[model samples]
Target: MLSVRDLWRRHRRKVFISVGVLGSGYLLYKLYGAHRRRLDALERELAIQRESEELMKVQLSQIMQAHFENIQTISDVMTLPHAMHNLSCRVAEELDLSQLLERLLQGKGQPSTLTQSEKLNLWERLKILSFTRMALSVWATTMLSLYTKVQVNILGRHLYIDTARRFESSSTTESGDLVDKEDQQKFLGTVDFLCQHGMPPLISDMEAATQEALKGKQLSHFFNSTALHETIMQILIIFMSQGSPHSWIKYVMPEDSATSRIDDPAPSDVTEFEQLMTEARAVLLSAEFGSILEICMKVVVNAVVEQMGAKFRGGSIAMGLPLARVLPQVAQMCPLLLEEPSKNQFIRIIKCIPEVEPFFTRLYANMPSAY
Candidate 1:
């Protein structure tokens, strides 16, 4: 039989092999724990990055939305010729200076009619009209400038977000990319057309790549849409009008004085925002497309001259060079003017005018379609 020492020596390799196996298992377990911790940390970091990215997207969306609102406002401003035209007639009916002057000069059989209050009221109206005229003069010129800039950058081209931002910044700050000459005539020429016939409100607020989108909309369709004006107000909300956080609470919960409303600054006046916007639009439109005073004066002059059988300022043109484009627009608005008997009488009156007779004859004489 083998002795104890001899058995120990022979089994030594087996003992060592078992110890090696245990050591390797412990090392693997530690490595696995470290790897799991690293994986968790990486996942957390990725989640944080995703949240930041989403926040950035939201901010970007708000900026883009504000930008588009401004563009629509500008476009709407350009298209207000028709609306302003109607507004002009209303103004004339309300404020007839001739009658007022007549009353003032002759005293209407007594000076009592033109009291201090009446004088103050007349002065206020005059001041308002004068201010409107001045504001429109400046604003309309700026709009023309902006239109030239937009067309040069993206009239026949696309409007990228960066380019649009440039436009917005340029409008506010008057510093950005330069506009090309190609845009100059394209935009300015349209101003004449707008003054003559007035534009229809745009169909969609989205910018179209081509001018075809703007060419042929019906004015009768968009006679009273308020979307354009409201869009301008939205722009005001984004840039100029600051909404008070607790102002609504005051309106809703008037008695609450937990901390006292006096602790906060007085609520900002939001109602004036609409007033400011409408006035701005009106002023710009009036300046750009001949003021109410001017249009009314033209009508009065046209009537007096037509009664004397004279041509109106040598046959003014628009829409394929029609003589006196304003008359057609005036006719469209007046049902009495559109009747066949009235139309024939008006034609005869025009035929008798010296400057108009030759132009009308030339217009119809060569064309097979003419009467």
Candidate 2:
């Protein structure tokens, strides 16, 4: 080493440079540590965001899956065969032909006051009435079943389309509101009409048709199987032809009960229900509905044919069966025809109707491909 002062002066520059280098190194270390901490924080934040995104994706998938299942269930349940079965059960309960026959047989008062011929005539009239009632019941039930099928089909198709549109747009709307509020009201209105008002006019028409078909005919002539079949067919034709689409709108959405709110301020406003009614009127006028009616007619005719044919083939007519035995047997068989095998046959016929098949095809085609 040199002398202390010389050494100090000579090395001062180097000392200063070394100290500056150390200070700069410490500052660089602090900056690197801060940047590293910031990067760690950023990575943690990104991980949380990714987890949140994945959770949302899972939840959305579940919701979409649920919506898909609901639509599938609706489609499965609203078929024509299912409708026939449901409506058949309802009609069976409502009409209760067996119970009706019993009541009719139990006269309002004792028959002690009436002469023997009067009793016979009354009995004959009761038989005709019962037969007519049975026929009318079948006709009304079938028509209503077809109508229910059509209504539900239309509703199902609408929902399918709506859900598809929503899915395509990535809508966050709840599936519960898929059916518009007004459309729901209109649907309920139709159910109300059918449950409350639809049957009465139909019953009245059936009664009128019965009277017209059997007017002036002798009781024996009326009770003959061939004659009864012809008469029933005629009555059905008359009943079917009685109402136009405009007239049916009254039945579908009755004027008295069309409004959802009793005191709705805008009574004349064209509500969604009114629009639905318009659509319903259009459906009623459509060729598909006409095809349905024709199919229903064929079903009734087929039932009558099978019943009459079976009776003849079984030699019930050839053996000179008593009217008492013959009539009850026929009446009992009428309801049975609506049971298993015949019901299945009718369903097949309905499914195959040329004009109606395309609707089913389109409805199924519109179903969503993804959940």
Candidate 3:
């Protein structure tokens, strides 16, 4: 139907179109194959690298732990200057203590020679940790000093009072309810970490530091400084957060039932009361209290009130004029703090104590001016 030239032109066009389709198909196939090959190679390389990294981590952990033990052995009885110098050398040479501590806590650092069962002896476990912390303290001081200083000046100063307000505001919410979910989780996570991995190490560190300070005649000096009070209050706040709903103080200071509940011999003097109030006030001003308020208000404040009331009822306070005066002040600040029947209970319990009745009567009479 077509002329020779036209037919030939049409045939060339078809041939060219076929060639282009084939070329495109071939190119696509090659690209797909290359992509698959790259994926396979990448996966294999990643597997190998991960295995190598894991092995290295294990080896490094073991080596570092060995170094720790060796250093501990050498420095345990060494003079303070010598010990501190040795620790500094280790920090400079081995690894930053912060990194080391992070790895150690994650269980990715050195493998312990002791089995899980073998490491349960509280005292022995503490000794080992104390040795490590003593070395790490210097590093901690260097690393955290700047950060804590800023926090103390800026955030820390307002933390306790702010926390109390926050806790009061948050009482209506559910356990995990927060506008910022991530923050809530982070706080809960920190509580868990302290409960599981932190407390023993902390107690160990404190005990060790106390012993060392005593040896150096630094206890009075340390006590006089706000630093020690802040630290203790923080620990106590952590404990309060993790404590049971019922009796946090009871758990901490178990009742000695042998003593009479009625009279209890009127606590001789007020030294114990003074000591306790000092501790409580210090705790009330720490970051821990702020954190507690941030997490939950009704729960913590109620707990604090209950515990404080228990101290009054459970013979923790005695006949000291200073204590009587201070007790009224604390009551004024916290102000029958717990909600509902619990708050009534706090007031009622104290009222029932014959020895404390006169103080409360005066406290109640003078309440208007006190605040």
Candidate 4:
């Protein structure tokens, strides 16, 4: 019904509308792509920020750890003087020199066999040492009286060594004849009491006894008797028992490696000392005192080698404080204690595995044969 020119115009109008719509659509698509790119950039920036935050957290943690270590170091240094002074006073007060000296000088040649003059000199020396020890005991007791209470009641407390012996015996019995669970519990309770209560006071007394011993004139002579020397060693071990297996290791013998002279004449004395040291270590292991055992063992090894003139292998004390071999098991039992020195020692001990491996391997290999 329309003319040709009208038709052409309408057609042209439709074409133009279509072209404009297409152009708008393409522009919108481009804008969407740009928006997507911007979003991705923002996400990347966020990710980077998160990564930076994590790095900062890690750095902060390291800073805190270092700060804590610094604090602990400062605290330890500040406390050192107090610890030293207390040790000196206690050492001076507790050792009795005269009685120890007399015991040292006793059990000699018969009066008839000895010249009268030599006998008199011996008697005089013994008397002088005795007098000196007594004087020191009196002085120390007086000086420390205000601070330390002499609990005679504690002295009356005795260990049921029989119970300990019985428990040991029971462990050896045939499986069928083994002690009942109830009996085992009772024995354990007794041991706990002795360890927790009995031993502490006993240790205190032992310290006091040693102070009495060291108070005598001619302190060197007091160390001469094997019996007296043994008693002193035993007392020292007991004093060390306070911190438990850990304390045993912590003790730094007044003697250091630079000065390894036993003025005491009995060369055999070292054997006895080593035996006691080994026994203390064995007890610690059997008790399963955790990482404290390892730390204590290291302390003991250091003291014996450096202070007590024991021996050494590698740079470490030769006495068996085998950290590498013992630490993994200890860490398993007490992971909480594994950090810093313990961790470092654990690593060192691991490195020493090649050196100590033969000893352990041989031990394990021999076990079946022993059975």
Best by lDDT: 2
**Model 3, span 102-142: residue lDDT tens:** 44344434447434544333323333333333323322222
**Stronger candidate by TM-score (1 vs 4):** 4
Q: What are the runs in model 1 whose C-alpha is more than 4 Å off?
A: 1-8, 78-160, 163-330, 334-371
TM-score of 4: 0.33
lDDT preference between candidates 3 and 4, better one: 3
**Per-residue alpha-carbon lDDT of candidate 2 for residues 243-287, written as tens digits (9 for 90 to 100):** 664354454455554333323423567565554444444555566
In order, the Cα lDDT scores of the candidates are 0.34, 0.57, 0.35, 0.34
Name the regions of candidate 4 deviating beyond 4 angstroms: 1-24, 51-55, 58-62, 95-99, 102-289, 292-295, 298-371
For every candidate in turn, the CA RMSD to the true structure comes to 23.7, 11.4, 29.3, 23.0
Residue 315 displacement in candidate 1 (angstroms): 31
TM-score leaderboard ranking: 2, 4, 1, 3
Q: Candidate 1, 106: how far from true, in Å?
A: 33
TM-score of every model versus the real structure: 0.29, 0.58, 0.23, 0.33
Return whichever of 2 and 3 wins on TM-score.
Answer: 2
Q: What is the Cα-based lDDT of residue 82 in candidate 4? A: 31
Candidate 4 displacement at residue 186 in angstroms: 38
How many clashes (backbone atoms < 3 Å, residues ≥3 apart in a chain or on different chains) does model 1 have? 1
How many clashes in each candidate? 1, 0, 2, 18
